[model samples]
Target: MSLNYPAEGRNYIMDAAIHGGQQIGTWYVALYEGDYTPQEDDTAANIGARATEITAYTELTRPELVESAATGGASDNTGNLAQFTLSAPKTVRGFAVVSSAGKGTNTGKLLAYQRLATPRAYAAGDVVKVPVSLILSNPA
Candidate 1:
């Protein structure tokens, strides 16, 4: 899936890249369930309010993102998949990477988000697997 980096994400990248702002060492992945569409101004709080977070899983507290090296200006967690074992059935619409590790908490910078091309419904014991990625390129 394609990822959309919000304003907060862009600024965070710039600050860590050029400025002296502290770089984020780890980011947590969260699954969202709703009809919410990600916007440029979307934040952690905004998303938490707009969508329902799927927290009925067992695995990493919040799936830690492990990305591959950037090649051709793109990096992804292809081999390092985030697997969530659902304790209850839910329809997952999308996912977001944030700075917070608490489930359903609205206290962190929303790094990136992307709605799934097709929503997926899971059974009570289903496992949801996702491979998150990001692409950086100059404007044409």
Candidate 2:
């Protein structure tokens, strides 16, 4: 899934790039099962407030995002797909990238989110793999 970096995310890039803000050492991907729509104003806390994060997974924790170098103005975790083995039945609607490594924690920046083209219902033991990307480009 491709990312749509929210306002906070945009600012984070600018800050880390030019304003001396601390660069995030690592970012994590979290899955959500709530009925929620991503907005430009959404933050990590905002997402946590509106969405029900899916934490019943067999994985030890949320997957860490390892991005490739940007080419053609895009970078992605294609080589390192986030894999989740569901421990319980759930319908997953979307995912978000956050600064925190702790599952269900809201304290951090919300980098981006993408609601799936279609929500997927998964049974326990089903594996879900996600590859995420970020693209930066000038407006045409």
> What lDDT would candidate 1 get against the real structure?
0.87
Tens digits of per-residue lDDT, candidate 2, 69-96, equal 8899988898988888999999999998
- In order, what lDDT does every prediction score? 0.87, 0.87
Candidate 1 off by > 4 Å = none
Give per-residue CA lDDT, model 1, range 45-121, as digits (tens).
88877777888887657788888888998888898887789988989999999999887889878999989999999
Model 1, TM vs. native: 0.93
Candidate 2: clashing pairs of residues? none
